[model samples]
Target: MTKLRLRQLVIAAPGPEVADDLRKVFQLGKPFHDKAVAEFGLKNSVFSIGDQFIEVVWPVKDDAPLHRFLERNGGAGGYMVIFETDDIDAARTRLDGAGIRRVWNIDLDDIAASHIHPADVGAAIISIDETRPWGSWRWGGPKWKDEAVEGELSGAILESPDPNGLASRWAAALGIPATTHPDVTRIALDDDQTLIFQKGEKTMLEGFCVSLQSAMKALERADDLGLKSQGDTVWVGGVRFVLNND
Candidate 1:
């Protein structure tokens, strides 16, 4: 079977404060700073949450795309959703027929990635990648297993004026089916991971659904750090991190 799974999420921040804040709230290990991102006029802090990653990137140059996204969104928020496939050629073939614009890409011995333009997809940037040794991700750094926390970013939420349309586009690109319901459109993946789209005031990443035992404790940490949080959710990088119900 072609194994494709939600592997990582990227958040855009105006500065490094959000990254530090995330570290404290989740009690996650120090970020794996990617020096390669500097080539795009950006600096990044990537955290390992189980096998999944949550990355924060800030602008270092005026002409950087990170700078433009920050300016447009008015601050830190969800920027990208990444999926990894066990079959590289299959993933590429699926994306090729989607008719979406690719803004950036990288090909290496261990991995390859393509970034879909936000304008074509609507909501956030979409990245689909394939890596050697399967389940491994290069952007999370070589020693990412050491930085892992007791949680996983198992699902993502996107809010849009046209949820159905956006969800369909994402589904087609990933070579998955989009199932529509009364209030949402969903693409179900392996291990119960899901991508959901809903109607909202603005089109953007609204939150993540996470699986963790210390979820309430994380909320307390968010409160201690003076971040806006309540119930089973905490606000980080201007997006909600919601504890998974299951």
Candidate 2:
């Protein structure tokens, strides 16, 4: 099986103000680009979190599904989970055999991506991308490699009533093994990232973890920005941001 490494976490902001709120909450730098993705009717800001990206997207049109997604999740939520794949075609074949549907196909000059429907995976939307010549990401802008700070994308947590079942489903879909336990289920990925499943009332994308230079410093920065934080976790744009020194 080919490797699927977590590359980016996408958040759907209810509006531009919420997006700006998150930027300040995380003390993130300027966005990668200001352009719009016409296919999704979205305008976005991309923040570099180590080699991984944290993207906040705001729908441009009233009819955009993103708006309904926000309504469903109560204003804002984790929208998508993107993975960098070693072989996209093989991944597509695997999904096809399992009767999984690809909601969108994004073919670009430097990349090819396929989006799997959330219904199929029982959680957030999943994207598998193949970059040209292997590890390059054009979506992160040309300056990402040079400008991105050093940190590690630790993993993401999915909340569900049946953690074990959802974890196994996601693991099998991504061709990974699920490690089940009494309290949680974990699927370890490349680059030390792990997909975690925790008990919840509804199955959904819950939160993710990122390692920073200093957790205390990050927390102080958040406080200085007037952002409310509990312990090492902060809520911005309705998603939990966990800061860690690792």
Candidate 3:
């Protein structure tokens, strides 16, 4: 099995207002090709965090899947986690054998990607992608290098009623092992990214933790947006965003 690394975080915004609101909180870089995905019934924007990405998807039509997702989750929040795999076909085979269903697939000149149904993963949608030369993503737009900000995605928190069970399933799906702790279970991915499971009544992609190159700047930005901050973490758009300079 090839190593899978966290590549992108997809945030489902209830509307464009919510999307713009979060963009300010993170002080994210220029919006990625938002217009490129319009035909898919989505209004989206992407911000480069180091070489990784954080994308916000807003539904443009009532029938858009994001709309239903927001309603089902009880509100807007984190939606999906996409991992870049070294061999996506192998990953697909493993997932298929385990009875995990793939809801979508994208094969292009620059990238290959697939989506695993949330039912199989427990909460948020999971995607596995393979891009030539890794870190260079065609979907992020041509200016991605210049759009990068000062932080890197450290990991994401997945809240579920059965943390252990969900962790085990995810670990199996990714062909990795889960590290269990008293309060949380961790699935380590390549490039230092981790999927952490925390016990909660509802299964959800709660938040993303990041390591900032300059925490002070991020904190100042959060403050400018009138968002609350305690130490290195801040709650913005109902998500616990951590900014660590360590």
Query: Which model scores highest in TM-score?
Result: 1
Stretch of 10 with least lDDT, candidate 1: 88-97
Pairs of residues at least 3 apart in sequence or in different chains that clash in candidate 1: none
Q: List runs of model 2 lying over 4 Å from the truth.
A: 34-36
Quickly count the clashes in candidate 1: 0
- lDDT of model number 1: 0.87
Tens-digit per-residue lDDT, 30-127, candidate 2: 77864747567888877787778988888888788898888889878888899999788898898889888888887887889998988888869999
Stretches of model 1 off by over 4 angstroms after superposition: none
Looking at model 3, how many pairs of residues clash? 0
- Alpha-carbon error at 35 in model 2, in Å? 2.8
Residue pairs with clashing backbones, model 2: none
| lDDT scores in order | 0.87, 0.81, 0.82
lDDT of 3 by residue, 1-246 (tens): 587888888888777665576677766778885686676679888889888898888888778777788788776688888888878889889889999999989888778888899888787888889898766687788999898986789899988899999898888778899999888899988778888999999888888888877677777877887878888887665677877784
Clashes of each: 0, 0, 0
